[model samples]
Target: MNFDKRAQLIRKYDVPGPRYTSYPTVPYWKNEPLSNEEWLQSIHRNQKHFSSDDVSLYVHLPYCESLCTFCGCHKRITKNHSVEQPYIDAVIKEWQLYKSAGLEKSRIKELHFGGGTPTFFQADELVRLVHSLLENQQVDPSEVEMGFEAHPNNTSKEHLEKLHTLGFRRLSLGVQDYNPRVQKAINRIQPFSQVKKVHELARGIGYNSISHDLVFGLPKQSLKDMLFTVEKTLELRPDRISLYSYAHVPWVKRTGQRGFDENDLPTGEVKRELYEQAKLRLLDVGYLEIGMDHFALKEDSLAQAFLSKNLHRNFMGYTTQNTPMLIGLGMSAISDSWFGFAQNKKSVEAYIDGINKDQLPVFRGHLLTKEDLVIRQHILDLMCHFETELGVHDSFDFNLNVLLRLKGMVEDRLIEIDGNTLRITEEGIPFVRNVCMIFDQSLQSSASREGVFSRTI
Candidate 1:
């Protein structure tokens, strides 16, 4: 690797960019309010298209015992456990709404429980929630992929065992950093001991895919600290590791990120080096890089998917499941029908109120235009497979200005354009987001100020 050349590229391209989890990212989602009837119509259309095949479900459990100051997810922090049952009831009610409204397909190909903290609820409550969602549905245990985000400090052995017994083969534990200073700065002081116990317990209960979530560019983090954290993490030998860049979105997540000093966070070349060094170490240790910020062993499904070119990206990051209809239930959860995107209300009160009134709870959404749909595919191709093909007589025409915008990146050797195809060079993998930005007409056409997204480094 050419260190000098890499450093120069990083300096030049390291700027605020969307992670490309979605083509028209949340901010650029047209700000269009979607009615319950429209949301159901989209679902009905998807049901017809999908036939009896299953869709994906993402259930957001927003309760957290405490705040992880560096977390950027939507969460409600409180010591009260009373909020659990009511929230679960509302979520189940919301799912029922979809079922009763002509969503004929109930078989779930994939189901994921995301934070604030999924294990914040008691094990029994979780069991009831899952059962409610799958009640009378055609869920084949062997065909389903189930997983959840777990906080090591709070996830009891029962939490692991119950979920495992219920067919959850994947588990992701948040281990941002083992360094005490870094943890303190982020207000997430979990020791390695706690992580080990949970990891071992999950493995003993037969969880096949265990993922550890780590972060770089956190407050007070350094190259040395990152190396040490990677070393400790490798000791665990998780099936997958997500080494994410700390997104300092204080304006959007004021209370969650304000505990740390901005100066303490690594920036620019320093932050880039942290990720590069860690990536090198992980690769050297038999972990294959899967898309951006994710590494997995050869046997992991994510790696297999990447190799087979069946990998997919969504609001839940990378996944082997590529269902056309992804139904998200709970406050602030976002659902995606191939043609549209909708988000439930962020406030728990409003979400439950709408559910109680037999409403869909979707407050906002975007119906993708023909142009938006075409650009979305190209961006997804770049993000998941690092290449995209455009045919001469393709039905969807890409913006000519987008191709013009790629001139500099192509000249810099970040990408290669051959005929109607574009491929990201090996040197351009780290700058994939920059490559995708060339096609982001929404961002290019925007008049917004800075700080809409984290730096691409």
Candidate 2:
């Protein structure tokens, strides 16, 4: 599509909405959270269905030496190395809680370390953490995928080597922008040299899938800056690229984003243009768009998954791994039991205390109803594959109101509905969230959109 057309569409459809990482997204989850016992039962049920099958694991290492003003993730900022060991110990204990809850022992299909910075810990400390989780367990080495988020400024050669030795084949380096003004605005001023060094180190250590993360619409960001960032990124030739829209949600993350002047941030058309510039440049360099806000080389597994319709998304973002269960360990981590969703205590102190008491540390969760499941599947289909089919399952009664609500989208050529199937047109891909919202019974029931989500653009 041309720039004028995309800009026009952006004006028409840009609105606050959930990314649909989870259908009946967290804010719309049932008021009565799932109990600890209920959460465990969901896990047991998952295990029963996929007996001895490998499950996915997400470990939250929520510590960073310095705060990135643009970051919205749950993290504690401190320079103290003393806290690392205690946090790692608590994470191990939390994993054991799931083991006691009947999670398949030593059988993991995918493991991801996300955080304030997974590279915050020393090399040996990471080894200890991975060993503690893998000890006496069976991992699907052939199919097992392990990865982590790294800070280019702090990630060391030893960190890459040690993690690679532990079967971690993927690394996502946070390189939001290399523009000095933008970096200063976001309070994440790592030089491009730092990122390049880390990238070379990881590649030399045999890490197969290295992803560079870039963000548009940051405070003081411009089309030129976005192009420069993508150009510099292509010079490194990462296996994957996560080109994201910088979500400025001061209401939700007041302190972390306080460093910048919101007035200086790009908005509306300018922000959309920044993304289009990045997207075009990346595609020119042979990177294929995968799902939303992500791109991968044709040889990358993410691209392969996208082509095969096997791509999956969860709290951990996009992945090729699909498992009935995902166990999240550490503060503010979330677990998916296929039938339910549970989140750990947000505070490190509270999480550690709960773990010491032999508790699951989950303070909130939601058990999906049949209808919720059906809607969840449709949303996932649209988000991952840009299409969905209704009335294909007995669990759901096809709601015509959805079609009625989306009538404008059809008229706008953003989507097509033929019989029981719905497909998002190429022009509709950017508005996939808006398309999904038509089927969101909860959001529709609430009928008030103020202060609930970031804009869909």
Candidate 3:
């Protein structure tokens, strides 16, 4: 199909869909019967799978100096530096509880620092925190990969150098947009000079990978504005680029996105055009598409992961490793033990209260059923590998449910289905979420349900 036809399909199919960061996404988790004992037991049972050294760590630092209106992440917008030490203390305490539960520190293969802004903390504080973690754990530096998210406006050279010295080789800077008008609308007044400086600074300090986080479909974002952002991004030539579609979920985030009206944001066909133009521009500048909403130059590790078929997806988005055990520390973090999923309290006060009481901060979780696990595998394959084959199983019968759902998509030339295997065609690339929704049993069951997710297109 041609661009015009593809554009039309995108407009028609670009309805609300889940990002599928996790199966039975967080909202669907049943927390009523989730107890600390069950969570710990699940962790122990899943740790056995890490005998070959396959575990990942996600450390969430939820503090930020200010709130970006377009952000949908869980965060506490505060300027008080005093909040930092207490949060770090709580995180370390939580880690201690996990350590006491018999999780061998040697099994950790990847560590990622994500949050409102990891660079919000002082450089010395970050160094101290990381050092303490390394001291308590038996981490293999050679096999470990560590990275963090930084705000370009406040990420100083010292911050980059300090983190780099502490085994952090990858850095992601949030550069949502370069347009002054768009920035004002989102209340994120970051100058391109600052972003460019930070990008060069990270590369200059020998950081292996530097990723720029860009967003499309924001309020007042036109094709020209997107072209400018892409052109400016190409000039910097970061190692990786995460081109995200702006999720306008005011009903969920509430206050964070209330500054602007929903109608001001780009809609169906226009939004699709913005993405297509950006993709073409990035490709022309030598960026290789790596799965959904992410692009990496040929030399980047993510691109290499694609080539080796080792690319993996988790709550933290794309990863290079397929670790079975992921332990999340800090406020509102979610832990995946392969067999189960647990999330800490979203409130900082509640997280602190649990830590002070010597309790695991988790308040909710789900133990994956046989069907959940099977569906999760299919979703992961489609999200990371872009293809999946169904296995004959007692719980889920292999039939035309998926193919039947894809029939419309197939007619639109969005996907092509073989026997039991399905692959997202090039035209379907932008609508990957729509393709995956065919296998999303939970979503289908809750389709009539209000306030679920944003459009997949």
TM-score of each: 0.97, 0.97, 0.96
Which residue pairs in model 1 clash with each other?
none
Model 3 residue runs over 4 Å out of place are 49-53, 136-142, 392-398, 447-449
Q: What's the CA error at residue 185 for candidate 1, in Å?
A: 0.4
Tens digit of per-residue lDDT, candidate 3, span 371-415: 888888888989997888855552434345766677888887777
For model 2 the TM-score comes to: 0.97
Error of 1 at 221 (Å): 0.2
Local accuracy of candidate 2 as per-residue lDDT tens digits, 184-296:
99999998999999999898889999999999899998888888898899889999999888887889998998997879988888898888778877888788988888899
RMSD (Cα, Å) of model 1: 1.5
| 1 versus 3: better lDDT goes to | 1
Assess the local accuracy of residue 153 in candidate 1 as a C-alpha lDDT between 0 and 100. 95
Candidate 3 is scored at a TM of 0.96
Off by over 4 Å in 2: 31-33, 104-106, 138-141, 394-398
